[model samples]
Target: MFNNVYPREKYLKKIRPFYDSDIIKVITGIRRCGKSFILKAIMNELIDRGIPKTQIIYIPLDRRGYKNIKTSEELETKIESMLGDDENYYLFIDEVQNVFGFESVIHAYAEEGYSIFLTGSNSYLLSDEISTKLTGRYLNFETFTLDFSEYLEMKRFFKKKIDQDIYVEFEEYILNGGFPKTIEFDDIQARQTYTRGIISEIFEKDVKTRKRISNVPVYERVQSFLLNNYSAPFSLSNLLECLEKEGYKTKATTVRGYIEDLKKAKIIYECNRFDLKSKKSLRREQKYYLSDLAIYFAMNTDNRLSYGPSLENMVYLYLASQDYQISIGKIGKLECDFITRNTSGDYAYIQVTYTMQGEDIKATERIKEREYRPFRKIRDGYPRYIVSLDRFRDQQEGVHHINAIDLFLGKEKI
Candidate 1:
């Protein structure tokens, strides 16, 4: 049924390995990033594999029909009524966190030999309580907004193509971001409106309500500040200073709390600074990137100062989605945008720039030095890349310069 939909094959492949494993399959991501849609996609896959529809019990707790099923007892009763005489059953629960004592219900169902799959919009789903309850019995799959390749697929589905130059497509993706709903709108105004609504829903439901934040205006200012300064390094004190300059009086601890709340909601991601020379993580002055570029565009009206940071933020999300352990690299005054460690114990140092296409000889030399300096500092033989908007490729002194479009499209591998 969802064949026409953008198949998040990358995520699907991750879940496939544990299709019928005893562990509960948990999908967690920000709101409106298509967690619920993925649940449906998985259900369709099961049906295609010869599983009867009656054997799969799909419950979306966010729906009004299930609003009253708040506690574990109520959830257990509903599941009992849906089960058949067959010993094998599949349970797909969407936004299961909406129900109280959901962990108990999940444990009970797993004990009864049901293959359980769950989707949640908040990080609390993996909190200590849930972890303790389902230890060694569950596997978490993190989902995010559509990546550039997925966004391009959506464009192709609509028979839409940008200018022959790939940068045009990249520009659109940077400006509008990769939200699935936003990809459906052709009009810029409608896209922005939809994007803004998603942000509001995130703030209202995920941040405000879940955190019980009383000073909403302060919370909003903090959010705006983070979005505006996305991909830049700043300490908690620096954020507090900026807020005060904006005429908002708030304490340092409160601002820290609000930022933590945003991270928990998956609205923003924080990358700690890793000292490459010493091979240690720095405690202060971390960089923050939005979960989606659309959040930055939605919250800020002016895109003047965002282009470069937008590119960097996109790279951060791309690497993160690929399951890389990412951190900002610091080598004594010089900084690289990302230092990623993969599962194979390999490391990659990446520097993201808006463009490296045109400039005088002196300017081009400066750009190359600024981007390549940090990579040269590391003595490790791992890959070092400088990703930019330039269409050309260059390799100098073991550092690879790749086009950003190629990186996003998977035409080039890091």
Candidate 2:
């Protein structure tokens, strides 16, 4: 009965292999990142594959009719009423974490021969019970806000007006970000308002309510600090000092815990630093990038794009959504924008900039050397790239100069 549900092929490809498998499929991501739509998309796929619509039970507990179902017992009773006598049922639940004691009920249903799929907004959904009871019985599928390519594709799907200029389109992508519902809005003010509501919703439903922040004021302070300084590296001591300066006066553990809470909420993602000389990932001095660029823009009134970190943030999200394990690369004092390892164990080093053009040839040479120097320090044969917003491409030594728009649009691959 759902209409205008744009398909998410990226998640579907990962889910399709387990479509008929006995193991429970668990999907997790940030709120408003289209996890529910993926559930509906899977349902549509099942019907297309000749699975009877009646045999597929989709329960979105957050909806009006189901929101009143709170406890596990209530959920079990509701699910029982929906189930038929068939053993080949495909069951899907969205935001399943809302129901207390939901683990046992899902485990029980999984054991009873239902091909189950589930989604939750935060990491807590996988903790405690599911980690123990459903251990080794389910596979987790990580979902993300749309990549740049999908952003344009989705706009086309809804027949929204799109900028013909690639740079303009890219600028809009980073500014408005890739939330599926945000596309339905017409103006920047509307989009920003929508994203701001998302932030409040995340803190209200996912953080304060579920995670239980005893000191709301302190937590909000930390959140604001992190959001305003997004993409910059900060030490816990530094953060603690900053909090104290603001008269928030919290303990290290409290600040640390709040940071973890933000990460779990998917408002901020932690990126650890990797030491090339030591061949290890450092535990401290990590940078946190926003899950979507809109998070930063929505929270702050300063709409001017800080090109350096902004471009870096876009590259980070792009690589991450493509399933790359990313780390900030350090070689002595020189730093690479990102050091990434794909699922297949392939490594790639990337440097990002807003543009390569400069006032003079000498200035341009200096910029090029700074971007390429880190790649030279690494003796690995893996791909190295200097990605920028330049309209043209450059091939210097073994390093590739690529346009950022092309990279996000899937026209180029590192």
Candidate 3:
């Protein structure tokens, strides 16, 4: 139905309500996160809904035909020549940020009631400038590299051999990550190599070309630090101290600026800490999660799985993709892995661990208590959970312990 395009229903379900509406759909993500592929899937949806192929326009600015259209005027002329006075036209443009001053052109079409869709590799498409120009005209839906479920499904789509034991595949999913394109490669070496290529492509086209870094070496160190230590909490001062300890002299401001550049380029996402006592968000000691675990695997030589942080990172991406506003919850000495709020003001607290089963009798109970302690301290009656790889799905102290495999495979929900 998607013309060889694997359907990302998580995305399509959100956009389906506005399929034929006048609202402009904006899809943004890291490089090669299948932004363009989702655009094609949307076009196929339009066709299945009885929209003619002629009335649907697919223009990828980075591709050969439109590569020369670098200015807004050129883009406007091309789009104008393609439109006609027939039924409503469904316009899809990938890599829309390639053309300078392209917002006005997109806004122009949206204003004319054309059903417009756009995808960009970096955050430039949703910058303050673009926001000001297209205010109240577009609804953005961010995409991620694949989540665990999609990773397994995509392998099936390509006819890759499947293992009956999902735990075997789980290891691969965590190490290989969820980049849709990277799944095309069968071996870990090829997949990791392709992922590294994506990292380089993003830096060249989005990061380096858009932002200037005077000290490339220092920035590289900072990048390596963040990539190597995903899901760890650190402050600028802490980072500065670490750099000084390593014999690298750089100011906190320089480190801060480089981190901002990486975040803006969609390579990393920062998660703030929430003080459960004060009911406020804290700026310091925040954790940063990589766009995909494959990013960490591609950049580092550590193949050993660190389930604590890796599972937490996977849950973070899943919650974010499901449109949950997430933050670290701090209650005095105790901490909850994530405090999430849905669009309807519903709240859910989560704790992620490798297992609830301990090495011994005391250790098993200690593991369970360690994970559920923070949830017990919470004053509110919001839904609390402990997500782990434990085979036992039981409840302790009113906290539900769910298997990570079940949580990701849609057999359960947090």
Candidate 4:
């Protein structure tokens, strides 16, 4: 029923293979980052693959019809009434967490020999119970907002042709960011209004709904502190102290709970610091990145991206799309933008800078060389890359310097 498709079509290859594999294909992403569209796209693919319309059923739980059906029994009755007994069924459920006892319903469907696909905006919609309940029978595909390349293609809606210089688009993309729905806003006020709406919805659905955090003041304090410190290392104790200074009475456990709710909703993602030399996660402090940069803009008036933190946020979202397990890299005091574990059992060290030229040259080299130290200490030689807004692509020593445009366009690889 949805026609809006952005630049994520490239992931279709990775997505299609897992279809109808007796696994619950769970699509997880931030709200409005196009999880619903991905499900719709999959449904269209199933129809084209000769799966009959009569055999397929799609339910968006956010709709009025299904809003009241929270329990498994109600969901079963609804699905059973809609699904025919004669044919193998393909079920696509959006925002599946709204249904109570969803895991049991999913398990029962799998046992009944039906192929199921589900999408949830909240990260914890499928918990350890769901995983254990459907063990060895589920695969997950993460979705993110439009990348620069995807945003470029999306620009076609405004003009017949795109500008030849992608840097222009890159600048705009960095400023406006990759959320598809927000692009419809033509003015700053409208964009801000829409962005606030998204933030409020996420806070309500992802945090307030699932968490027992009754202290709204403490919750807001924690959220404000985290939002302001985007791309910075934060500890639970540090957060509690800051909240106290700000006149909000809070504790470390409460701050931790608030942060956990954000992670469960997939609103804010944590990348624990990894000691590359030890190849172990360090527990001292963790870095956080929001799923969408525009939301960061909406939350805070001060432009932190001028400090180039937004570039790090962009890299995290893009890497999340590539099926990479991301963590912050630590070598002594130096930190790498991203430490990704590839499928082939190798690791990648990536650094994102707004530009690697001029005054940034010395600092950029230090960042690159610092990344080498920990891997060198461990005798590991997985590829290390420097992604930047540099107009030219160059190779320094063994480190590859790529333009952000090429990185998003899939022209560059690690």
> CA lDDT, every prediction?
0.83, 0.88, 0.88, 0.76
Candidate 1 vs candidate 4, TM-score winner = 1
Off by over 4 Å in 1: 1-4, 158-163
- Score every model by TM-score: 0.95, 0.97, 0.97, 0.90
Scored by lDDT, model 3 comes in at 0.88
Clashing residue pairs, candidate 3?
A: 146-178
Residue-level lDDT of model 2, residues 197-278, one tens digit each, is: 9999998888888667878889998899888877788688887888788888779888889999998888988999999999
Clashes of each: 0, 0, 1, 1
Roughly what TM-score does model 3 have, to 2 decimal places? 0.97
lDDT value for model 4: 0.76
Model 4 lDDT per residue over 80-162, tens place? 88976556888888888888778888888888788898988876766744676778788877778887877777778544355
Best of the two (1, 2) by TM-score = 2
lDDT of 1 by residue, 12-129 (tens): 9999877776589999999889988888888888888998887889888888888788898899898888888776888998988878778988988888778999998878677645
Say which prediction, candidate 1 or candidate 3, comes out ahead on TM-score.
3
Q: Judged by lDDT against the true structure, how good is candidate 1? A: 0.83
Q: How far is candidate 4 from the true structure (C-alpha RMSD, Å)?
A: 2.8
Better of 1 and 4 by lDDT: 1
Which of the two, 3 or 4, has more TM-score?
3
Candidate no. 4 TM-score: 0.90
